[model samples]
Target chain A: MRIWDPSIETLDRVSLRQLQLTRLRETIDRAYHHVPCYRSKFDELGLGPGDFRNLEDLRRFPFTTKEDLRLNYPYGMFAVPMKEVVRIHSSSGTTGKPTVVGYTKKDLESWAQLVSRFMTAAGVTDEDIVHIAFGYGLFTGAFGLHYGAERIGASVIPMSSGNTDKQIMIMQDYRSSALVCTPSYALTIADRMEKTGIDPATLALKVGLFGAEPWSEEMRRELETRLGIVATDNYGLSEIMGPGVAGDCLERCGMHIAEDHFIAEIIDPETLESLPFGEWGELVLTTISKEALPMIRYRTRDITRLHPEPCRCGRTHVRMEKTRGRSDDMLIIKGVNVFPTQVEEILFQAEGCEPHYQLIVDRQDNVDSLTVEVEVNDQIFFDEMKLQRIFIQQLEKKLATGLGVGVRVKLVEPSSIPRFEGKATRVIDRRSR
Target chain B: MKVEQISIFIENKSGRLAEVSRVLGEAKVNIRALSLADTSDFGILRLIVDRTDEARKVLQAHNFTVNKTEVVAVEVPDRPAGLAEILQILDDVQINVEYMYAFVERCSGNAVIIFRFDNVDEAIAALLGRGVNVLKGEQVYEL
Candidate 1:
């Protein structure tokens, strides 16, 4: 029921569109005059900043991709000087070169404000103690949430990732009311609690804001029941202002996008054509209010839909559904597109299956095969070999039916699968290898 | 009639069995009787050790999936058809033997065999009803 900065959040559509148009023109001029990459892109289209008449004209500009950012490397995409830029953050660059982003002093202020909006919407108040588990480094997830919680005037414990036992101890000692980390890490905490016989009812946790990875609704239920906290989903990417791009209100519906700061669009990935509302497609965002990194229709590569209807919480901003998965992370097996979260949904429904699992895809004799390696715990382990075999057979059958493709299930010991402190890596595709 | 045994789940990779053995050996737990059942991917190493609790503790401390089970150990006559005669009695009573393995040492001049049955209590009663000698947990552990 609470709204942060209702003046901007509750603005009428007509006034919001007008504000976006004015900001879009300034962003275009800044990018075209300062950044060489944007200038060349504009030159190639023979278009100038003066040609923009309305919002529909944004589609004419060339879309920016992660590959383009990497091609420019560090500082090539910045629209301001180094002295004006106060802080710098970057992607992990696991695939290739890490794409660098810089933020000016004003940019940091806006970043905190944007994050504060979502934090308040998720039911955080100044009386709450926020415990952040995201790692602090070149990655933006931790710092993004850190400043946001500070902006809300709440007590913050910057307990950066790992040391699950210590994390639980501090959560109990500090009486943290707000938890910030990826959804998978929350499950890891729940697992450690079960192993140590720490009851969730004794903890003071109230709300959990999880992001940086795709998780299923079933996982939300699992976390809520196991941790005795209300779990909410938020969406953001390092390429665009990190954690505060959009978040859920107390209504527990889709996340409301910060349309006042950034413009969101959905387009078919293969054809690059715009799609209607309520249709699933790749997300494209353009930072209209950014001063340093003025992205023009940057391809987010995340797949989700948008709901234009007003939410019950009284915010008029359009809400975007939780992304199914990133376009790049989707696996193609036997010509069927599969997302890891879909596999997660099925595993959570099974009684004895743990939340920890890894999908290993390999090619043998020019055929693709998927092997889901699940962790074996006390509940799933059987002393009798016959019962064990029967349990595995039943799991394999369930997985095959749920996945629509035959899969082999391999059971490993508990804590065998590597637990991630940040974003969880759930897939290993060896077809290219 | 029901003897304590530890069953460990181990992957079928080289050095795994040796590692489990090294842990138990370093803990000074003597293996009285043991059997290994393996598939292509993993194996279950079942052991009746001189110290069941210590062996399970050491194996688990070394990160092996260890579980405790109760199995029936019987004293078999040392003749050629001695094992078959005891199994025939179990079969006549409709009690199924899941798995059976021979022990390393003899008990009172008879061959000792460890049997894991579907119904452990029923198999023990059937063997005892046929006048067969059944070893207790301490008798098998100290053999």
Candidate 2:
């Protein structure tokens, strides 16, 4: 169990770029000769190892997407033999097909080191007990953190998502020191804690590493205040390792990218061209240390910006603001593009509706109509006429203010809607003509 | 002794019921007796139709959350003491009725009452053994 402090993490901007260039050269050379997928792609573009002498030439490679991973399917993109692969993780595949990721023994160690580095950055020590609440089995969130916690020499709880009551019980009984899960689940835990008459502030949790879904600053403020713990954001995709790519320090300003193991790029999602510092665009990543499967310029589809300025915490790695939104996850209601997070923010702020909501989109007379079914708590009694009217009016006003479009809000009873244990299915698009 | 009943879970919203009706109507399926068991958020629309399979297909094609169950329909004379006789038999058997609805039998001087009981078979046997007329699936479909 070892930890890298913020002051001694690794590589300044100059040395970091140099290290990437060296790794890029070796990686390209290996891929060109070994992997048939990369060999044909490189040959088609008339590119060679010499062409990738620096970061600029790395652009000569084509960008990989989630669609590409799916197109290749099971083992099409493996750069190494099957015997060399040791572990596999996959995306949730809620949108379409699941993207499969494989790793070798060495790859696992590298992933563990990077994740341990992230935990250490968030102040996790060997004496801490980490309660990992992310879903395990095929999903990278759980196992990625599991190995990392073991590497950091922390006692792992492996709570593996859902059963909020059991999670809280273990947190109280075991005196857990840290929590790892999606931010939504963390809020749910806090909500359940209140209902169970337990104060979250009295829990043994000192820090939380929340990610795997796009969350807003308002959500962070709510979670931190409710849970009374230092909540930090961890960013990763199964396409490029797992939950160890970058993490936030105590500064809470932005997540620090592990530039030593991976290269981070921001490009205009539509134009596919690079954006300057502080400019919002799509995030692209290239894994230099991954062996079983290495991706070059993979479009992450997450909307965020890169801050090149060094943080006051003394970590020299580049910092990125928490993801604002995902380009693909945006739902077009009528003519306006609406984000689920925007609706969530309004629901949290509104005095009417509970946090549970579902967006129903259907086509009527060749025009799309968005209906938001909001679950109201005990505050709105169905038998009370006055309360019902007030609830509807409050919800409609709040939704219009938050989304900038007129929305129809249907008040429903609490717990009447379906609850998701993993990624929430918020939007249902039924527009078949 | 046996009756086919279709129950569909529907989220309470404008035009949802209309949409379900439209699907069934387009399929030329006639609904005999229908009742909605509702809460504030969602409702279960229970129906006895002329063509249960066709009605279910239509509803499912329209993406309605529909399910099928077995119920009992008893035939009673359209006169005083007709329903009382049926209730006396059910009470003797200690069979509780969760919900019940009525439909007049076409061209017959009798009313067909659909009963969703805690125990459908026991209720059917009790009414039949007591010499009470119980409608079969074909009889209910014909009605």
Candidate 3:
């Protein structure tokens, strides 16, 4: 397989470490000088950019958390001024308040390059037609893959999410070869195709790039077999740079991080102590080449280990395992990241709904289905059958649109859900892990 | 006039039907006519009950989703082509029947058919205009 940017992707260990150190120092100095959040953090740890003698010094610095971004709100953590920042993206905030991120013109250019490297490594080329199904708007998944696919000179069908039947028709008529979407959504499409009697093998799809939610090896096999494509996984978060952060090569090993732009570290979640290579722990990332919002040892709550050994595909960067689970209470159903608290918040927003709700996630026919059993108020108990059915449909639409995931809402009777005295058990994930 | 039918939402599990019966039996609410429509996950238990409000209240108290639906009871000839004659009237008037089930007992040698219609009032008017026997809520609950 051909490697993209071999000089950077397969750099020698000694030279790669030196480049990482230089970029790290530059990021620290930028964050400390311009962003007060990072300055205060560095001061709180009694450290400075000059204090970094080597890569190991990243441990002495205080870790930045998602709470910090929320506290900073919009643009408070940006290293550059708003005038210089040409693009902006914010989290979906399926919970409550969203975290905003900005990128300068240079940042966007660099982001596209990083993303292009991954698409190339996964065997996508100018001849391939990439169909991006990730939803557009404030979410970064679509735009990230869009720019990268364009950068590689590939024909892009920017068919952003939903419209399942139309998507299949375009995929067939346009003869698109690459599919970029969430793993769960890929399975959903495959299942829909089978139900419609559309032979997936007759399609021109050759490669699949899936991410944004945790998936299993079993799911990868299912997608590959049903979609007739070579499935690959990529990793990224909007708080950092999105989709280009890391991706798998043709070898189908772990995803290779773009070491030149970001530093990857794993730490034991309980003690916050850094763990050695090949050990399972929480993945921590630091943006070493960001121009707008350079993160300094940002804590990504995803739990996984890293393999630093050289990949068979000839890439020298560290590879992180597919995120198995989260140290926190985050549920990824049908490729949408959700928190149970978000479900409760939506439930409370709708009238005639009780505070009690149970989220049931089950995987059937290689796709994930989320069913929210919401307790209805006593007042709704006396509603006419027609009105009750309308109410249930309205609640279903509200939750699905709010969370950006198709949710099945069941109007259970009041007090049917068991009350909890302590930390409430809000989610019953039956997806078989 | 239309009859009040109690529809209970039930999970598809063993002993669930018996549990609904036990709850109603304890509450002394007699089920006059009943039918169940189910898929793999859940079932809808439709019943013509002697006491609509009481059955719904006791079922709700026992943590069952209960709703009162309006359905009409039509007495058809207890012979060949009886059900076909009723369907032909609905087809002629363009009145859609959502679902239908047979009552347990017969009235004057005629079979009682319970029907849920898209517009209960329109179906009742169309049935009565065609000289069809449209039973009232009180008579169907007793039968």
lDDT of 3 by residue, A70-89 (tens): 88887799999889999989
DockQ, prediction 2: 0.06
The candidate scoring highest on TM-score is 3
- How would you order the candidates by DockQ, starting with the best? 1, 3, 2
Scoring the B chain of model 2 against the true B chain gives a TM-score of: 0.92
* Candidate 2 global Cα RMSD: 12.3
- lDDT-best of 1 and 2: 1
lDDT of 2 by residue, A1-433 (tens): 2237543364577877888888878777776777777777788898877786569887778787766776778778888998999998776332334568899999999999888988988889889999999777777889989999899899999888778899999999999989998776787788889998999878899989888766678778887898898898999888899889999878878898888778888999888888888999999998887889988788888889999787877778888898876767666443234667777767776644448889987755334577888765433333223335666778787776566457888765445579888988888878541
TM-score order of candidates, best first? 3, 2, 1
Deviation (Å) of A210 in candidate 2: 1.6
Q: Whose lDDT is greatest here? A: 3
Cα lDDT tens digits for candidate 1, A279-398? 999999999988888899999888999998888888888899988756666565643335576667667676445478899987663346899887765566676778878878888897
For residue A383, model 2's alpha carbon misses the true position, in angstroms, by: 31
Candidate 2 lDDT by residue in tens digits, B48-138: 9999999988876665555677888888877899889889899998998777778745426778888888788889888889888888898
Instruction: Give the chain A TM-score for each candidate.
Output: 0.78, 0.76, 0.92
Q: Which stretches in model 2 have alpha-carbon errors above 4 Å?
A: A1-10, A94-96, A330-433, B1-76, B79-101, B104-109, B112-143
Q: Where does model 3 exceed 4 Å of error?
A: A188-203, A351-354, A365-367, A418-421, B1-143
Docking class of 2: incorrect
